[model samples]
Target: MLDIKVLGPGCANCIKLESLVKEVVSEKNLQANIEKITDREKFLDYGIMVTPGLIVNGKVLAMVKIPTKSTLEHWLEKESSI
Candidate 1:
């Protein structure tokens, strides 16, 4: 299973990113543990200096912006396969 983290404060972008991640995971029928990290201090541990960051399997996938759905799907698919 993939371990996914959505890092950000409780902002619009952060919520959107989290929702999108959940959607993709469901659509793909992927087994993953998706977490939303809202603590500012925790963000630093991921080296995230911006809101709306995405981490998959402990690797940073996006920072500061929400990725396209297709891109998100692709990344999740690739990671889950490993």
Candidate 2:
């Protein structure tokens, strides 16, 4: 399963990112464990300095901005291959 993490401080953009991840997962029929990490300390532990970050498995994929559907799907697909 894809271990997906969305790191943020629970802002509107962060919430929207979470929704986008879910939508992409359903659209792609991906089996994933989606996690929302809102704690700043935990977010820092991952070495991410930006909000609304996307971490696929253990690697960070995006930061600050919400990702497009194609990008989300592509990242998840790549991670699923591993």
Q: How accurate locally, in lDDT, is each candidate?
A: 0.95, 0.90
| TM-score of each candidate structure, all chains considered together | 0.98, 0.93
Over 4 Å off in model 2, which ranges?
none
Give the per-residue lDDT of model 1 (tens digit) for 1-82.
Answer: 9999999888999999999999999999999999999999999999899989999998999999899999999999999999
Candidate 2: worst-modelled 10 consecutive residues by lDDT? 64-73
For candidate 2, the lDDT comes to 0.90
Clashes of each: 0, 0
Runs in model 1 with CA error above 4 Å? none
Question: Hey, what RMSD does candidate 2 come out at?
Answer: 0.9
Between which residue pairs do clashes occur in model 2?
none
**Weakest 10 consecutive residues, lDDT, candidate 1?**
42-51
Write model 2 residue lDDT over 1-82, tens digit each, in one string: 9999999988999999999999999988999999999899898888889898888989988988887888888888888988
Global Cα lDDT for candidate 1 = 0.95
